[model samples]
Target: MKVVNKGLRAVAVLEACKGVVSLLVGFGLHVLAGHNMRQFAENIVSRLHLNPAGHLPSIFIHSASSLTDARMGLLAIGALVYSLIRLVEAYGLWNGLVWTEWFALLSGAIYLPFEIYEMIFHTSLLGVGAFLINIMIVGYMAHSLFSQETTDNQI
Candidate 1:
């Protein structure tokens, strides 16, 4: 009765990777809130060798400078919470929990509309790839959920 599906394992790994990246980004943002953010932004621009006078670079700097400490804190908290959720989902999926399959399906489905919307308005190779990947994930998880449920009912 135990399931160790390869597709679910792949989804688990992907979720775990997302969680780790989110954690890193959250921690970085949290730390930046307590320091000289302007200096940090400058350091980033310098390391990237971006032209300070360029419009894009100026917009980036302006946006960075405009982020208040409270905003950064909120963003960090949100990221950390999201990371925790993804990690939990990954754990459940890796352990072959049925709830995690439902969770994964719902999560992927929830983003479907947004992805489609973005692709409609801003079509690009990367956007298309992301949309396709999400679609595949959603499709696989949905299939797994329904097939398992049907088999269980038959038994």
Candidate 2:
């Protein structure tokens, strides 16, 4: 079945909206993590040579370090990249660019397997929703991109 321009626009809006939400969420995580890290620093100051190494303190220290570590940076970068991708998709949707449709669909499809695994492992309703949305977007993207190819070849 062929997908229409409206479908493309709707998909673009949906994808871009998700990016905005993700950007906000990533910022929220950074803020929350920063708060926890500040509290950890306070502990180090007050305990000053009192307990060189205690289990709970050590765990907190490690947790704080891990939370602010490289993975967080990677996550931040990923969020930013996805935000740009979403913006590009929005533009592409407005212009009716098939490349954007293919890109969004392919990327969305790539995300689904991981999301599906997360839904099963974490058993979260949110994860399930994300997986389902990705699944739906994949179809629209694929249909639009595919139809474009067929039309182009006829010319």
Candidate 3:
């Protein structure tokens, strides 16, 4: 159906966007690995007018200060791997691959528990939005898979 194809394309675009963001983040981490992260955090807090002594700002600075080059490199590598998976899924979905529907459904569903935990505890608008969007994508993928199976059986 046209509607189903459109939904797949839309989700493919979303997956591609997520991949790009992760890729950018990996590149950023790579670039920042050898830099003065504490000073960078301080600069960010200063530019944002956040009190350096404040709890969140202080934690940010401390966390940044504690980052080792090895740790940063490992995180960058993890982000790169995540980006690659997402991009591949996006490509498969764009091509209407059945395997990609299953992949998307499983991947999206895997985050549901974590998202629900975040919504229950942190309760941020961004967290809620991510949860809703992920759930919708998972549901759509499931529906698409089931419809395909039914069509195949009827044929």
Each model's Cα RMSD? 1.5, 7.3, 1.9
Select the stronger candidate by TM-score from 1 and 3. 3
Write one digit per residue (lDDT tens) for candidate 3, span 1-155.
22348899899999999999999999999999999999999999999999999999999999999999999999999999999999999998998887888999999999999999999999999999999999999999999999889988999
Candidate 2 lDDT, 119-140, residue by residue in tens: 7789888888888777888986
Over 82-144, each residue of candidate 1 has an lDDT whose tens digit, in order, gives 999999999999999888889999998999898899999999999899899989999999899
* lDDT over C-alpha atoms for residue 76 of model 2: 69
The C-alpha lDDT values of all candidates are 0.90, 0.72, 0.94
Model 2 TM? 0.64
List the candidate numbers ranked by TM-score, top first. 3, 1, 2
Model 2 segments beyond 4 Å from truth?
Answer: 1-4, 26-65, 69-78
* Candidate 2 C-alpha error for residue 24, in Å: 2.7
Winning candidate number (lDDT): 3
Predicted structure 3, TM vs. truth: 0.96
After TM-score superposition, what is the CA distance of residue 54 in candidate 2 from its true location, in Å? 21
lDDT of 3: 0.94
